[model samples]
Target: MKTMKMIAIPAAVLALAGCATTPGPDELRTNAIAMMKASFKERGQAKLDRIDQDDMQRLCSEYVGEKVMPKEIAQSLEKAQQALIKYPADGKLLGDWKLGERIAQSGVGKQYSDDPKKPAGGNCYACHQLTKEEVSYGTIGPSLYNFAKVRGYGEQIQRYAYGKVYNSQAFSACSSMPRFGHAGILTEEQLRHVVALLMSPDSPVNK
Candidate 1:
């Protein structure tokens, strides 16, 4: 049953993609805009323009389901993404590890039913094994257990983790991880907390 669901989803997506008949890039975008406008109705804070793509998104979509892009294009994309990361203004890289755990475990907020004023979750556990006790973690990303110990708790690792969480595309051009900080899904405070979870020796991830 689970396997059937997975196949069905891809089939549905392919069907939808086939429905897009526009021949050129500009026309394809126009058709996509029209399709979105016709299929969805604005409700709460979910605007129709939300379906619109950013430059990176458009570039990535152009190669959807195909082989990997050229190395030059991939490097160019990663470089652009790295430039978009925003560190905390206070120069502090770590925060409460406890708070970070909560954010990492949570998968709430950002849905149409969610309150926009409230902070969204990092939902890290959905893609990475964060600790020994988290038996329910997904395997989409590499296990992050002992992240600090294995990588060594240092300035470089701290910066790398923070930047990767901020904009994963900087490290992996086709990473499935969401650009939490880059997309404004989480604030600097929240980002710091999450970073602490992955970097602090005291955090469960390190243990």
Candidate 2:
């Protein structure tokens, strides 16, 4: 009985295999996207639209595995991203570092459950060491404990800091850092505050 059952299964499998073809990369990609779309239920501000990748994002995805992003492409992408940074017209990049610290510590905002009426958070502590006093912090990115101190508190550095927080991809293509200002995840004032957290001499990050 067992031998007959085993033989029957392979015969059924062979019959099924003969009728079906393997999916290619494009088909597989389409299927995967469809599966992902079906898997996550849309709710609140988080809709199925989040699954849609922008052109730059799709381009970045192409070279994600076992492939190097070309230097020319990377430079061009960085230039394009740099162009997206809109500086405050007043020419002031600094804000209240104290408020900035609060924003960094708060991980609230930008979730399906989060209240969109409230201002979003930078959540910098989730990926950076912003101060020497922190006993715990994330290390996904570099430690920015002495950001301004190490980089120097200058206009150029300040501009770089604001641009970086606004759109990190401006400096590094395919960076995992969120484009707070560029994406409108954080307001312009919030971007300035976060920049102050990194660039202000009075900031604990500099202390």
TM-score per candidate, in order? Answer: 0.84, 0.91
Model 2: per-residue lDDT, tens digit, 111-154?
89999899988888999989999877899999999998999999
Estimate every model's Cα lDDT from 0 to 1.
0.91, 0.90
Q: Encode model 1's per-residue lDDT on 1-207: one tens digit a residue.
A: 999999999999999999987598778778878987899998876777778878888788777665668889989999999999998888799999999999998898777788999999999999999999989989999999999999999999999999999999999887789999988888999999999999999999999
**Model 2 C-alpha lDDT versus the unseen true structure:** 0.90
lDDT at position 84, candidate 1: 95
Specify the poorest-scoring 10-residue window by lDDT in model 1: 59-68
Candidate 1's displacement at residue 104, Å, is 0.7
Candidate 2: regions farther than 4 A off: 1-12, 18-20
The lowest-lDDT stretch of 10 consecutive residues in candidate 2 is: 55-64
Clashing pairs in 2: none
Question: What's the CA RMSD for each of the models?
Answer: 10.7, 2.3
